[model samples]
Target: SSLTDKIKLQEEDKSENKKIKSFEELEKETRESSLKTLDDYFKFISELDRNDWFGVFVNAISSRFDPHTNYMAPDDKERFDVSISGKFEGIGARLQKKNDFTEITELISGGPAWRGKELEPGDVILKVAQGDGEPVDISGMRLDNVVKKIKGPKGTEVRLTVKKVDGTIKVISLIRDMVETEETYAKSSVVERNGVKYGIIYLPKFYIDFENKDSRDAGKDVAIEVERLKQQGVSGIIMDVRDNGGGSLKTAVDITGLFIEQGPVVQIKSAGTKKEVLYDRDAKVQWDGPLVVMVNNFSASASEILAAAIQDYKRGIVIGSKQTYGKGTVQNVIDLNQFVRGNTVGDLGALKTTTQKFYRINGGSTQLEGVASDVIMPDRYSHINIGERDLENAMPWSKIDAAPYDTWKKQDNFEKALQNSKSRMALNEHFQLIEKNAKWTKERKDAAVYSLKLDEFKKEQEKIEAESKTFKPITDYQNDLKFKPIPEDEVVMQKDESFKEKRERWFESLSKDIYVEEALNVLDDLQAKPVTKGEINLKKKGVKSK
Candidate 1:
């Protein structure tokens, strides 16, 4: 009950509801909207059958305990499985239902569509045509129906009328293929500054391919990357989990094992049971050098576990944002069909109920107060209401007995490095603009209801835009890095054309990463500070402005 603290929102008096003076006009519109809402609900109910309502009832009951606990129907279970497997047969682009069209949000690396290079994120799909056949306008269509139209058997072709982010229209054809989500996997690159090389590992998500178990492994892959960096004689390591939406818990524990020699990775406590400490008993440390973990508001669950463990151990400097996403619970999929017997009417799905809560080795639950960052940064989500505390009826934060562990053996100069970085960040113009923009965004969100008149609305919108325009070129920051793919990956990329382009794009992004540059700066300072004989012997790495 105390895993998430409730946010205290300052309430306005009821008198604020009477802002509009025209009561008669409001009453007239309210009746018309009431009928329209009823019509919409009726249409929604008309589309449901027996299983739909059954799933709804179970989910409604499940969600009462917390938001994470929910019942998944048959179709929902299949989709969940697909998401975990990270494999599907489609055009390999993630689509979201925008106002009237399906917008491409992200493209799977090495997929047929990504290799085509004709589509990009923010492009709107207006129509889908199968193999030169008559095109069907998909604007305003249901997302599932639109997906069905775009997907086909392998070897089939689908053409899309795409409205680009620049507002240009183009027709692009792509062959249907089984898409493997390469972006979810761990990738690494080498960055050089001040005569020292740093290894940067960007883990988008702690992905584990369950359907094809042998196909991918997050921990094993990361370990291999660390070994590759070690061969290059890297001075420090930076694990970037900024946007990672966590996945496999087992993988998270295993990945943490790669850092420390042997110790507890995390603690798990099931309801009505004793706590169990998951340990790395093998006494193997993959990268014993200086380490840093980067996280933002979106990093959660398994990501928090790794970051928390590292922080608790003082094994690395945790940077970015006020805190990580506060999700510290584990869920178990319960098959509802198992409970049904004796001529079960139809197929029941499963319930992914929260079964256990986790705790950091230092005894803090990352439920409400996520893993707090040591170095807070100015980011876009800083002013947003998007955390566990913002959720209705979220679990509160709590504490447990601290697990038996020792601080990192190489702990040295962390405080010095943190203070030095804070000083540098205070003078950074880009970060200053970010903080200003965050204030502006909060003010706009607080305004809430806006003027309905076209002229007034336009004036307000233009004013907001003009104020925000001062912070353009947020992506202009760049730092030089001698990035090289692992020897084994270079060999594979040589043969795979799509993989080569994807790797190139990844390198380009790294060049423009302001966060990565700052991380290296911290690592450099940590190394420069005096420490235990072997902890840090190098000089301060240089930072150059373009």
Candidate 2:
């Protein structure tokens, strides 16, 4: 993956050979032209005639395939470090390539960008400016450079002209700072239904930095959280692994050990070799109580590893919409700087290569076919048909022999109880509401004619607003959105069909969360069972219901 080879091939083909010489040459040109820091460096780089700066990134990353990985060039090295550390001196917001514009995905909570009160998800930034003059139109600009321009020092302000979700245009100004907590971790909450209490833990991502032996580890912390909930006397625990794109392999093994007493968590079969077993070291079951795990299309890797282990051990019930992210490959960062001595590329970053695919003890590979849940929930992603199944180079799903564990066997009738619970839920009001919402979401997602004309847009927005009135907003999204408490117009609410319309809008409005409701029901079942014979000696506590 040499730049010379790429450039030579381009030249021989008589195609546009747009490639920078070396980071040194590029920086020399920038300095000779009087460019200084990141802002100047990026502005200068933006002037270069290259559409696929992705190539430059790829080459730079390849250097990491060996520890000698050095980009040699100063600017590229800075950018590389930021991406890996997941820390950047900028507004805490995620910008995505959306319809020829960098759309704001979500304002990271507690970030300076989110504090601006003007930036929001679905807002599109049309222009960026450091000063008050005419803004630099970033339309069609490379995503990397566009991001570089927006990120700056803690006190420096970056102005952004944006198109809001309401289809109005405005300018938002925000100062920047470093982002903490690179990887999302698991968080827990309590839920109650019919007087039964349940503990819910939402795991956003599995991250373990073995390179930096943390003073505190996420996996151990999560295990502690589970134990705390058990002490609180939850009837059941629901581990939510939705959108968890995974991190450390070792951490996944350690986390799974908390559920199963002592057994292999995941079996790794590398390139036609013997299968290697990763076993639990703790020999302690943190919470052997009634358990369920939640997953979605985005849960993969370490997330899959934990999920598969739980399922294989029959330690918990896997619940959610279909399969997970189906990413079971392990990647190691190789540093090229270490290998290619005297090469100018500083720490050439790293090359993340897929080394092995992991499988459950039962022989199922969480590759293309992610771990199938014990119960399925309705999701818009189900109909859209995206994931490992759609990818070209995706690995195929397979199975292996199941591993042995002997904890949940005591609750042999759990499946029958679960089936009975599911049947009851299908006829429940909350489940029906979620079904209606799912249908509504499918319609909106499938709509082909999304428009901005006031009448048309307002009609759509009004419909959504009306549907949202059925249930209180989940969490504090309304306040986060800076929703103002405008005086209610009874006449307006009456004149519009929004209020009277069915309150079952799906993706946009979670009027009824059937999965959560069902989960609560399961919790109730766990509670209905008599307290263990030995548990009566302890003081009793009344259960809280929601």
Candidate 3:
């Protein structure tokens, strides 16, 4: 049987090196790699018989309505809660299947894997062993199975034999612990440049635990960070929401409140209802200074809401990609079991239904068009089609009457500031190289297929590798600004040396970031403008106001 063949190929000792020559050998090797841990499939399949297949059937039907809507079983709902909260019992590392290897994408801060200091991004996990048991070779195994093998009860140990990017292998033992998704939270850094303090807050997502009373929204965290930055006397703040896939609609509105005084944050149009304008009732502005919000094609929902609100109100200059991810529609999960009045045969799952669509205060829906950047910059995904329109069965965009909102008084010269940024970005060599790299990357992605012929393949790979070596200068770009982590995080950084090293590398990358540099330039231009525009405060917290 085919299963027997798969099992034989999968169970075979992968350590036995063989020089593959012909196409037939290559095909065999691929199958071996793809089916390396074949028993996992059988084990997983055998356990899935009890799952509610009807839920999947209904979900398929529901997906046709919109991509955001879905069906969730009880377990799925539980897992979804865990994902949103960023709290789960595991080794604490994000993994993705790449080139037939489950590679570590990112290590969570202060987690078990981070504490172990052995596992790292780009390390390919080859095998997983549970508490001194037989190490299960996970090479080419399904990601689902790999996760199952790795995730066990808290306090249990899981050993992973990982092949590093350098091609060396090492077995690392990590104890499973509760890794609270600290990465999802807001983190700030003070970048001092030319006697000016600029604050940068990186918000990975608009995360909040709706079910847990102890968990706070990301907006609260952002406010705290803003206060800290205010304490440091930052002239401007760069709220980076680059790849943030939005969450917590309430939190998005709350975060926008931090910059502007008060007004309509976002407009919602649910079925059979008038447009609902969510207002920030608090009239006090938290940060009455220049602000720049960073977003990309991956930024969606809550991210788009905040960016769009800031743009509509002319409160801050939106910078980065041409537009954000166009996901304006909202979905609410409903328990399917509630519909069954009588005792059902089994527990039915919940349905995540598209109940509403959000629009900007100025009336344009961010469904398909998203929010356009004020200072558009060249990014890796600028050319790629990765927005709401690109998604299957996405809703069409519509417009409504604009909500009443006042522009930030001090930003009367905002247009000139944008032009100044554009002029500078045009002359920057770093941005030019980035644009070139984006084109090159797209072309490479288009022609990624390799010739199965060994000689031809080897030559092509060599050519690519040689080309890669030429990018040294651009990759090595560094700025004079020294980025310092917030004082609160310093204690944790000191305890975990690896975390500090990771933070150091991140800071170094930020220094090289042309976008951030341009944003800083934009902030400077705003400050350089006429003082008569508005009554703005640019002084430090301790300084006496004139």
Worst 10 residues of 1 by lDDT: 1-10
Model 2 earns a TM-score of 0.65
TM-score of 3: 0.77
Which sections of candidate 2 miss by over 4 Å?
1-46, 49-80, 91-139, 149-178, 182-187, 190-197, 212-214, 344-349, 386-392, 400-407, 428-517, 527-546
Q: Which ranges of candidate 3 are over 4 A from the true structure?
A: 1-53, 89-178, 211-215, 487-506, 528-546
Candidate 2, residues 1-546, lDDT tens digits: the string is: 122222333455644656646645644554543322346546766677542454556545644442122232345455655655676678877776654578775565347774455776557787788856546667666677789789888888888978654344566888777765632545455544434456776665566565778555668768877876776667788787765667777878887877777878888877878788888977677877777777877677788888888877777777777787777667655654677878874444444456677888877788778888777765545554445565444667777776655545645556754675656646554434445555655555455575645356546655664764442222222110111111232234366564323111211122134455455445444544743434321112211114
Query: Residue 165 CA error for candidate 2 (Å)?
Result: 11
The lDDT for every candidate, in the order shown, is 0.76, 0.61, 0.77
Native-referenced Cα lDDT, model 2: 0.61
TM-score of each: 0.77, 0.65, 0.77
How close to the true structure is residue 102 of candidate 3, measured as C-alpha lDDT?
94
Model 3 C-alpha lDDT per residue in residues 1-546, reported as the tens digit of each score: 122223333456376564425556545755674464476655655665445556647767987989878888777787776665577889888786665679785677657887676786557798898988756777656565688889988999998877654333466898998887656678889987656788999987887776785777798999999999999898889999987878899999999999888999999999779999999999988998889999987788999999999999899999999899899999888988888889557777677789999999999999999999998898655666766877678999999999998888866668888887787667666667667766765665466376866567656755765665554455566555578898877887999886677567667668776677778777776774433323222211211111
Tell me the lDDT of candidate 1: 0.76
lDDT order, best first, reads 3, 1, 2
